[model samples]
Target: MHYRVAVTGLGIVNPFDGEGEPNSGGVTDFFQRITNGQSAVSLYETQDIPRPISVPAVRCAAFRPELRLGKALSTMMERFAQLGVAAAFDAWQDAGLDKEYCQASGMTEASGVAWGTALGGLMAFERGYRDFWQHGRERVPPMSVVLGMNNAAAGHISIQLGLGNSALTYSVACASAATAIGEAFQHIRNGRAKLMVAGGSDATLAYAVVRAWEALKVLSPGDKATAPQACRPFHPERAGLVLGEGAAALVLEDWDHAVARNARIYAEIAGYGANADHMHLVRPDQNGQVAAMNMALNEAGLSPSELGYVNAHGTATREGDPIEIAALRTVFGRHAEQLAVSATKSAHGHLMGATGAVEALLTVLALHYDTLPPTAHLDRVDASCAGVAHVRGTALRGSKVTSALSNSFAFGGSNAVLAFKAVR
Candidate 1:
């Protein structure tokens, strides 16, 4: 018998409230910001770059892990690891599983952690290189290795939360976090665990990191003046994605187990699909995207017409938005025109590896509240993208939205789609 997975809790830290500050108000605050068309993207002065070029990107203004994990533990963690642990702590607490309760219930040994990231500790790695190689420093930070490791976030969460079973990390470019959450759902569905902390985090706001993206020519060219309107997904004059930093975690529990514990269920992970393009590394393949969506719908036992909303992986790049729209049209046919689709990246900016998880949480909120977050700054949809129903201007309300899908396609052609259904 396959166990059903229920989302029991959620925690997130995004640049939604400005720089470095956690969305302390949690999902409620995030939803409000998205619906209000507020954007997190901003023009930041680069310190590591050769010239004084201002790049548009998302940076957290503050991160106060000391409030939750104490100063000692917080100091040991890099930014990404700290974000992961903080999100996990919020999820754990929200799931109603405190230290005493977990000890008594033997939950410490029954659960695990599965996290994701494209670049583990980019800042740490860049700093280590600068200190040891470029600057000819005698020694680097002792904890640099721990901070830069790909598995650091998952490892930190496991150790801090006493999850004894496993601590797995996925690094599939943009698909990382969605795949992590999908695997966590599988762990519960397959009876290997009762609960898990599943999500992704990335803290790659270093000067080198931003410069590297600029070299690829895929970043937005928003100077300090046009930061708010920089990322316009599917819009006629869309430029490119603005990188952001964030961590988002969800508590996935067995449905029956959650009910037994009187836990509040946010939604159900009805289906998940992940695959590779086997095509060009940077160029997206419509066939790959369509296949992933079909796989998810098939696994969910859902027809194309049953899908009410879709959280698009809209990066606002001219090439990406059209390709994504074409794929959606191919998969859903005429029904695609009626689907309430939106890309929150236009507001929150692209969180890279953590993007999938962050958007998944937003998708959950959309389904839970029956409200559709708009694609901010989209004054006019691109002609190629106009065939579909784009939620723009204001949040669409009172829609009978029951099921939705969050799509994530990555650099190396890794694609992941997760299907979520309302519990009611």
Candidate 2:
């Protein structure tokens, strides 16, 4: 936790005007919208099964669902594979790493990738499945299985980035990306690698998947009529969350290496912690979430009051949102009220595996701009978020955020809390 790692450049291929804009759509835009009392969830007319929150899902700010990977990777899984590759390239450029060869050198077999995906290659598999049923093995596509592996996103990232070190994909429901980042941070901090491209990508808006969520009774039902009223995190009338797609990448550098190259520093990786509750799969657990947050705080040698803002894991679900706030209160106590909290999920829907890094990037920016992002659809506090300053409707200015925490709680009780600070 003492070692210093700075975030130099950032690259995002998210939905809402993704990379640069008055409000980059993807996750940040998602959060900002919810904070502004709006919802990106519209009527997804393409798959009209009814329901309002069933709007067209978050398309990548960078790629259309039909976007091809161009040259080498024309495989059926190219959509996901391409997004992961493009996001990595964006991070490289953002970090000012030379495409000719800002080159990642000496990457070992143990070099880390950590691609986070809750659902992998559903789009490809969906078509593949039908083809298999219709055309039989003659046209099943030789790479069907490979593309469908839950680890395809991470594996493709390694191959594209030339990551000779370590490669692994996490499928821990929604908290996948956050877990990956925590691991990537550990690798660099421990002298395992010089830099790591860490993040997640999800392209699973297939009919079957949506049907699964619908069966679980968590998918938003508020089409255009009251879509904004749908994913209202920490708000009273909030129903549930919308689903989205994105791939936000971050370049994690070794502290010494970053300073040696004179790279622009964004924020320091102060602390990280992850834990599993084993309590329940879908239901929320306040204790496990709080424990992870406390562990990160302790690891950072920070007190609850020192945390200026919290990037809450506000999924806007009936169970998850309030449980997240309860965890905050448990960890911050009386200072919970003083701490500002915002739900990126309120806007972005749930990026599943991408939420952690996406929200972590926003937290770093909050420290940089001194303006905490708001929890868009937060009109009235649910009983759980009653005492906390869940920033809503508008952004707060001149916040002295010396430190902040980004929380990611996923299904199966996977929880991760990352503590960050401005690079002084």
**Per-residue C-alpha lDDT of model 2 across residues 1-424, encoded as one tens digit per residue:** 4457677766666665534643334434544543454555554545333543254355554454334344556454545555666666667677777533423444445445767778877766777766776557557667778777777767776766677677877778888888888888878777777777788777656766777787888777765566545567787777777777677777888877789888888888778889998898878798898889988898788988788999888877777777787788888999988889888766667777676777887888788767788887565787866778878878887877889998888888898888888766
The C-alpha TM-scores of every prediction are: 0.96, 0.89
**Alpha carbon deviation, residue 288, candidate 1 (Å):** 0.8
lDDT of 1: 0.87
Q: Give the poorly placed runs of model 1, Cα more than 4 Å off.
A: 17-23
lDDT minimum window of 10 residues, candidate 2 = 47-56
* Cα misplacement distance, residue 322 of candidate 1 (Å): 0.9
TM-score of 1: 0.96
Clashing pairs in 1: 19-60, 19-61, 20-60, 20-61, 20-62, 21-62
Local distance difference test values of all predictions, in order: 0.87, 0.73
